[model samples]
Target: MRKILTLVIIATLTLGYSSLNAQNYKFGHINSQELLNAMPDKDSAEAKIKKYAESLQEQIEQLQVEFNKKYQDYLQKRNTFTDAIREMKEKELSDMQQRAQEYQQVAEQDYQRFQAETMKPVIDKADAAIKKVAKENGFTYIFDTSSGVLLYFSDKSIDITPLVKKELGIKE
Candidate 1:
């Protein structure tokens, strides 16, 4: 019975010591949005996406203008046309409208794909910088405060944003 009590006491002490050791973890937080915005690559990627979107908008606008002109011409000339000719003209206009709509949808999808492709490298670079900073600084866990999901973190936790930005060679 004495040996059993000694064993239990040893086990309790070991568990208490392990729990205390676990409390020594180094936690950190960073505003990822701030990091991303500071990246030079992000600015260029955004500019590329904006330009691509504008080109698509211009194409859609041109199509709309062409459609409007054809529709107006049809309205002005419809009374002079035979029934069969009018039907053919109407079908042609309908086909043109359908093609324009299809092109707009395709352009929208292309824009999304382009934006994703353009941003992927920039995002990867930022993630790598953050990971490197965290590892070098002995951070056990780095939470993104920019996501707004962290309800509360003590001020005792380190903010590693500047460290990560420095790792990426980003100024200020």
Candidate 2:
């Protein structure tokens, strides 16, 4: 009776352990930044930003040139003019400088707003693609490896960065 009881106890423990092991979860990890970089539209987005920034810079340069021309003209006339005329010229130059600064600031702000607006949609699309891929692959959970927020994960976690990039329509 003692032998039978011992065998039964051992069998019960072994079955419990095997059952627990059988319930293993499949998970995946992705570096969101890596996926974003691999996106086909990434280069296009960067080009757009570059073009916008360059356009702003050109406008600012034009303003600077205009201001400089006015300033030099004012300086040239200052020595030959009366006190009232010189004062007027000085005020005009100061006002031009202020206007140029204001224009540059406004342009910079506009660029920032445009970037935020345009990139928001792209980011949302990428996020949706990640979710879809995770669902299709039967992933229990997906962690963002680039975010440095995951405290722990086993080696069994699938690195799905490339999969996400592919899902996002990245060819390379």
Candidate 3:
């Protein structure tokens, strides 16, 4: 009876120890903002937007310069010419100004729309890539480090931002 009791206690302690050690939970964190910014495709999209905006701005500036020159010429002639010619030149200048404003508005709207369209797909792809990384790495839960809301984290080695970024083809 004494030997059986000792054996039972030993077996119970061993089973408890193994069970405690088996409770290994893996978690990961991702700096989603950093990854998104570092993506080359996002850089390319941003560059395209900037290029378009710059081109539109340059065209607008050129138009303004031409309009200013023509207006100055008209002002000089107004002093020496009939009221009809002066009014006609003023109307032309007003119409050109209006058209320039309209052009800028249209360009801004187009750029915004394009950015939204381009970003939606990029964001979706990044999300899918993150999910794939999480599943493959056996992460039970993944948190976004960029949110600034997680106040408690027990382990830093589980921060998988770099790994996820690499898997998504983002470098540096």
Report the number of the highest-TM-score candidate: 1
For every candidate in turn, the CA RMSD to the true structure comes to 2.1, 6.3, 8.5
Per-residue lDDT over 1-172 for candidate 2, one digit per residue giving the tens place of the 0 to 100 score: 9999999999999999998876666789988887777776767787888899999999999999998998888878779999998998888888989999999889989999878776776788889988988889988888888888898888989988777777776775
Provide the lDDT at 96 for model 1: 96
Q: Considering lDDT, where higher is better, how would the candidates rank from best to worst?
A: 1, 2, 3
Model 2 ranges off by over 4 Å = 1-26, 148-152
5-118: candidate 1 lDDT, tens digit per residue: 999999999999999988989999999999999999999999999999999999999999999999999999999999999999999999999999999999999999999999
lDDT of each: 0.95, 0.85, 0.83
Candidate 2 shows a clash count of 0
Tell me the spans in candidate 1 whose CA falls farther than 4 Å from its real position: 1-11
Ranking by TM-score: 1, 2, 3
Clashing pairs in 1: none
Model 1 TM: 0.89
